[model samples]
Target: MNKKLRKWFRGLTAGKAVHFLLALLWFGLTLFPLYFTVVSSLKLDNEIWDTMFQLPSIPQWENYFKAAETAGILSAIVNSVVISLGSVAIMIVCVMMSSYVIARRLIKRAKALNLYLLAALMIPLQGAIVPIVQMVGAVGGKNNFFVLMLIYVGLNISISSFILVGYIGGISREIDEAAAIDGCNLFQTIFRIIFPISMPGVATAAIVGFLNVYNELPIANVILTKTENRTISVALLAFQGDYQTSLSLIFASIVIVIIPILIFYLLCQEKVEHGLASGAIKG
Candidate 1:
């Protein structure tokens, strides 16, 4: 009977191994396009098409430099960085402060404020495109990095604030009251005590906000008229045409754009998950 059971267990294990192998095959199939991009980026014009299906003979390290130099990508990279970081900075301050007030019930009319915040969250950015463009146009920040930063910040606030408020609400009220009894005012208690504790939630919100701003294309497309001010996502369009397609450069440029996001995720994903698991959501 024991030998029969052992044989059954081995059969189950073999079945699981087959399933795992199938899953891995599916994963590779999914990742094929991304792999093609990286490999194609390392090949030249004819080299790209002629050997489109072939692996790289030699790594094309110069594609990185060539793409940057040819596409005015240096300026785009700088613009993208400025816009992303600037948006993140503004988001951190406003969302953190707003979430704190909502979480702590600092406003006497908390219900009204909560309703307002919820209303804002429900209003999608795409729906506001018309008025947003007019406002941005009227304000005359066309093609400016500073203006793009403001546009990004205003657009992202609702969802970021909502998530942050939920995290903040999870924090125990006893801590706030304790700090108050110890001669700490609302500002001090918020900044000194609550804010530090909410760093994880704040990090999570900031990273999401940063990714949104960095990857933004529509608003940037409408607002950014100058080549110098265009974000990398917008600038990647430079490699496309009706007849002539620079597939190699397109692949290289895409790799350049994706690499930064991958790096940021690798570094900050731990902090983000840590904050989500803990109650440190508002600051």
Candidate 2:
């Protein structure tokens, strides 16, 4: 019995060792580009071409300063933050209300509405660019920040609502009944009771929506033609010239642009993961 137990323990240890090796390989592959970017961003323009992976002999921190000044990174950061947060707030409120109503079957055609929303998930945003651009122009929304915000909200609402619906369905209906018994109206019950319970789903939707809006390039590129109105992703174009691009400046700017989202994800990673798992299981 002791011999058998020892063999079992050995097998478990070997399995863990194999898993660790695989995880290390995956981590290296995932980290390589970011590491290369950071190292390249610090090299002098002349030095950058010397070795692909070698560490710079002398770090050129001035590349960041140049990138910031030339790219108008500060203004772009402000624009991205405002648009992303505003769109996320609008999306959450709209998605939560709509999802709750549908999940609870409060309306006669709730199923139909839910079906329609779910169907929209199959449509890619790329296909709608031309029509959206034309519509924005017809409505005189070109180069408008608020118009961009509205577009972000509209594009994200369907998926956010879909995620919330599944999670909201998993919540107890008795909670709504209880809220209603205590003199809560529809909006009150949803805001005070249901919304609080569905936070995991909300967190997931918020993160996803924020990332999409913040990193979105194509829509922002086409819609925001003015330099002053550009978001971070669109503003990166400043580093590119007709004949040549500034590699060091571009990479430095990329590092700056990536920091905020990386911090946000790190802070809320647990919530995001939990939300995704719960939504998937409930869905």
Best lDDT among the predictions, by candidate number:
2
Residue-wise C-alpha lDDT for candidate 2, range 136-246, written one tens digit per residue: 999999999889999999998888987898899899889988998999999999888988888988999999999999999999999999899999999999989999989
Please give each candidate's TM-score: 0.82, 0.91
Clashing pairs in 1: 168-282
Query: What is the per-residue lDDT of model 1 for residues 1-283, given as tens digits with 9 covering 90 to 100?
Result: 9999889777777779799899999999989988889899998878887887788898788988878887888788788888899999987888888888987787898767867877887787789888878988798878777777887888888767766787889889999889989999877887799889878788888888888888888889889987777888888888888889787788888898888788989999998787666533333
Error of 1 at 172 (Å): 1.1
Cα deviation at 113, candidate 1, in Å, is 4.5
Model 1, C-alpha of 192: deviation from truth (Å)? 1.8
Each candidate: RMSD: 4.4, 3.3
lDDT of each: 0.83, 0.91
Cα RMSD for candidate 1? 4.4
